[model samples]
Target: MKLNTVENLVRPVFPFTAIIGQEEMKLALILNVIDPSIGGVMIMGDRGTGKSTTIRAIADLLPEIEVVADDPFNSHPYNTDLMSEEVKESFNSQITLSQKKIKVPMVDLPLGATEDRLCGTIDIEKALKNGIKTFEPGLLAKANRGILYVDEVNLLDDHLVDLLLDAAASGWNTVEREGISIRHPARFVLVGSGNPEEGELRPQLLDRFGMHAEIRTVKDPDLRVKIVEERSAFDQNPLDYVESYRSTQDNLKERILAAQNILSDVHIDYDLKIKISEVCSQLDVDGLRGDIVTNRAAKALAAYKNEDSVTIEHIETVITLCLRHRLRKDPLESMNSGDKVDKVFQKVFQ
Candidate 1:
């Protein structure tokens, strides 16, 4: 389908605020949105707990982005495009044109997908007709500067998972096939969801995710009924329902934008930094990514609170969401990182 047409047809259904519960999951996703450099988030949960719904809701919350027109990869205008001399000159000349903002691209990588489809392959017909190798961009290319969501990620083919991990870690995709060599920016926020009961993700891949969250099916009768009613009302008239929540969504967008502006100036004090490092040290997280994400998340919380700097309270609030999944998992023992975070905060901040 045409990109613009898809934008209109598949309007994001749930506003971020409209989601019922799963606060940690929601906050982790939002933190990623605030700082895509934090890597991505993996939502592991039981089925039918709004995992996919929360993803869709996040898509809705995101404000539109502007990019170069007619660039298949949605290449940023300021970025250098490594193409043939002729194509590069044309692109350089075209850079003077005005920019526009459209919805951020959100592409789904399906299970059972072939390597060729995920990473693109040579266009055989074009090669035969033109006597030149033509490269077809894949899902990763399409998801540039946006989100690449994988449902049932644990079940994904090992090779495909490896390809994703490589691209995500490097922020680039190099396609050398059929005697053609090409490289392009393929940076994107990777979101994956799967039921833990089904299987476990490879530890290497799991560690690549900046944060992890879980959700459970609501058992309360009234809350369940509320969820059903809200969904029913939304389905009955989606446009009207979206309209009703437009203000809420706009508010969230404003907050995100404000946070982006405020994030740079928000300081992580020395004492808070030491406290955060101590907490992560206590949890025995693997690497500095935990400390980095913890610091960033604390700053984001401060931005959200309109604080001038990250305080001990901000560190206390974000430590769990940032470091929970970074802890080593032991099948024999239950590890509630939340309780650990609470204990650390009580000891440090109190």
Candidate 2:
């Protein structure tokens, strides 16, 4: 289940491009990868819709990045913002730090995880006995600059959700004990998936996710059969099935890398920004997060398409996914949230 912990173990990861249907889910993941600062994605759908499989595939699709060798936090070799304090000290000392390339870390947060496990614990006993502060790095430490996924996120405790939101927003994890403190970079793309049939996530918590993608069982008979056959083929011979899609996967990876490089330079028109806010205002979104995430997601979509400017098409494509979950829910109303968002968008943008 851990990508970084087991090196000797070899397992076949299904190629991202080989997956069938779930266009919205795949697009949300790709947009986040192209721009991790879009917060993270909230995927709500039917059970067994390839949520976990798609997540793993996306991680495997990415190319390796350079990190300071043997660092628990996966500290970047030269990026101070991504470097741990310890690595920063070494960097400041002009030490020649060794580096290695590794696939992006994919950390799965189990529902049973405790606070101490998610956030590293300060070793008070070691501090008292040896007069040296010791810290046991936790899941957050290992997930730095990677993807942190929480399955069945609706079932996770609210306090734990709060901690995750805080760390995700701040891009850092701080552990304090007995007046001693330890902090490090915990920046990552936070992906959470759950079944809507089970229960809906709290609106406040759901709002924190930058974009929300809802998927359903593929109803097209031929497409469903294709998906089944593909899964069967992959299960029968994972390596060969994965290899068949190597060219498509490489193209996807190259697009992601290129989009990331040009994201900062991507621009959005001032009139479009005003229209985005107008849509949010008309929808009665609680806060400005919808407007901001919409702007960011629009820019990301434009970048993903290799365009340097955000247009109405980019906004139209991403606005529903970004704002649907942010709207106030009516217990008595049966209308779909996405439909409501689209209606508001079309009205305002027109």
Candidate 3:
């Protein structure tokens, strides 16, 4: 029998392994993939630092996830928690749901998007007339179990930001209109990037992000030349350029998948956890989010590094990313907060 297939447009996304520098930003993105509960990453960097390119590359690098076929929510076939209400009901009724492996979604929320567009609207007229509930899913529904990227997120409308904060915080998007209600999973990695020159997100929205990664333009002349040459080559012949790095991409993809599989087995020491909290306390970070995200990010890094247990090295690398945005100070300032985190991490760990 001939195998059925669906061909998606194969954009020549730059290979994640081929991305030069921005190691902090790259690592933050990878950790979120390994554990989305690290919440998500707020990537602020200078223009032309490959911030958007890196995000897209990582999205392309992610492994395909098993999902219910024809499900708009990208519902997990067996995980009722991850499934849409309709899918769950069908599953509970003993329906044999069709399944397919799909690339994890990558949703780019346009700045001009309206509330109804971001959060699906209920078809009240149809529901009342036909006596059948009709709901139209939106970007949040489509982003379920994937990556929701909002470029220039600092400039997003306050109302939209409120909607995103709610969805990201609760992992669910609810739409109610005219007494018609619909809710669906909105659990996805919320990645936002903006140049500090543009503006900054409010502390509340900034703190909503689990980690903060700051990237800078490569300063080394040789490295700058290399990045330029690589981009030139990609633009010249995207397909061939991408193919040259296929092996490296496959290896990195395998590593990420393996890390995810072993993530649950990774453990952190109680003393180390205490030190993480101490570092947060010293930083004067508000609430327990900083401490919790630090611990989770540290564990994720250890797992990504193929270590069974967390270490100071892991904590040192991830602490800054986890807590920098949570500081009560201005979020648009130069990334010296990362240095402060390092300082406190050193003092606390000692």
Candidate 4:
């Protein structure tokens, strides 16, 4: 089967609207989509609270991206790779083909993945036979310009985490070994999830994430029953369940596209910007990335609400989602990050 057909079959196509309540987590993911440069979000909480579900649902909400046909990396036609002599000849000679509306790539990085598997390795047989270095791209290469999800990310090997952070920061990956040097685009929105009890992510790795959300199992009896019932019904008839919510999902897809266009025109008043910066400053976030992400998220919130301008309410709503994970650790303090953010919001936004 062709790759696109295979993707549609294996990729779990979940409707964004079908997900149960987890508003903050959902909104943060949407904002990252609006502006991928905002970096990726880390969803930390207890297991079975739908962290994976939320990440999977995001695929349905995104519009299909156009890519070069048969390129393992989904290299854009305008990419630097096209500047190479071989690729340039192919393009100039009209030997390249264009792809259609394929599903957005959302690849999972499993815990036990090997370094060679995560990053491309030299194709030994091909290199030996042809006497030329040939590269085999891996997960990071395949995940270009899309979501790279790492479940149980805190448990990932230290070297793997370092590789991820380096690629994320540079937006490109370079490999130099055994008479081969190749660099390709590796930009992606990094989404990670883990239970804190398993193991805590290192501070360096933690700081790379732009936003963090905590998802707890719903405690309310009524909500819990509804969640169980929905899952049961869906499993009994997956296609019918998916078909029923198809329109709702389509509507959300349109909204995301509209929000992307509107985001450029969405203005933030000076007062609101100052308030957001002040909240981050008061929290003593380690870098300016915190303030920048906070402002971007607040603007996204305003756009999501169809507001022409950002308001103090938007700032208040986004403050916690932006600063919670970036705060200094205080093991002796009993207060959670959310509580600390709430206290600050109440004081500043009021």
Which model, 2 or 3, shows the larger TM-score? 2
Cα error, residue 28 of model 3, in Å, equals: 0.5
Backbone clashes in each candidate structure, one number apiece?
A: 0, 0, 0, 0
Candidate 4 Cα misplacement greater than 4 A, ranges: 1-12, 78-97, 123-131
Total clashes for model 3: 0
Cα lDDT tens digits for candidate 3, 123-222: 7888999998888889999999999999999999978988997898899999988877888999999999999999989988899899999888788999
Q: Rate the local accuracy (lDDT) of all candidates.
A: 0.79, 0.93, 0.90, 0.81
Model 4: ten consecutive residues of lowest lDDT: 79-88
* Residue pairs that clash (backbone atoms under 3 angstroms), model 4: none
lDDT of 4 at 197: 91
Evaluate model 2: give its lDDT. Answer: 0.93
> Residue 313: error of model 2 in Å?
0.6
Q: Across residues 223-293, which tens digit of lDDT does each residue of candidate 1 receive?
A: 99999999898888888888899888899899988887787898878977887787777777788888887
Q: Rank candidates by TM-score, best first.
A: 2, 3, 4, 1
Clashes (candidate 4):
0
Better of 1 and 3 by TM-score: 3
> TM per model?
0.88, 0.97, 0.95, 0.89
By TM-score, how accurate is candidate 4?
Answer: 0.89
TM-score quality measure for candidate 3: 0.95
Order of the predicted models by lDDT, top scorer first? 2, 3, 4, 1
Tens-digit lDDT track of model 4 for 1-350: 45667545663455779888999899889988877767788889888998898898896678888677677776666555423334455677877557544567888998999988888888767777898778888898888878899999998998998898788767777776766677777878889899999988887678788888888889999999999998888788777888999898888888888888898899998877787778778888787888898888888878777787888888778778878888889989899988998898788888
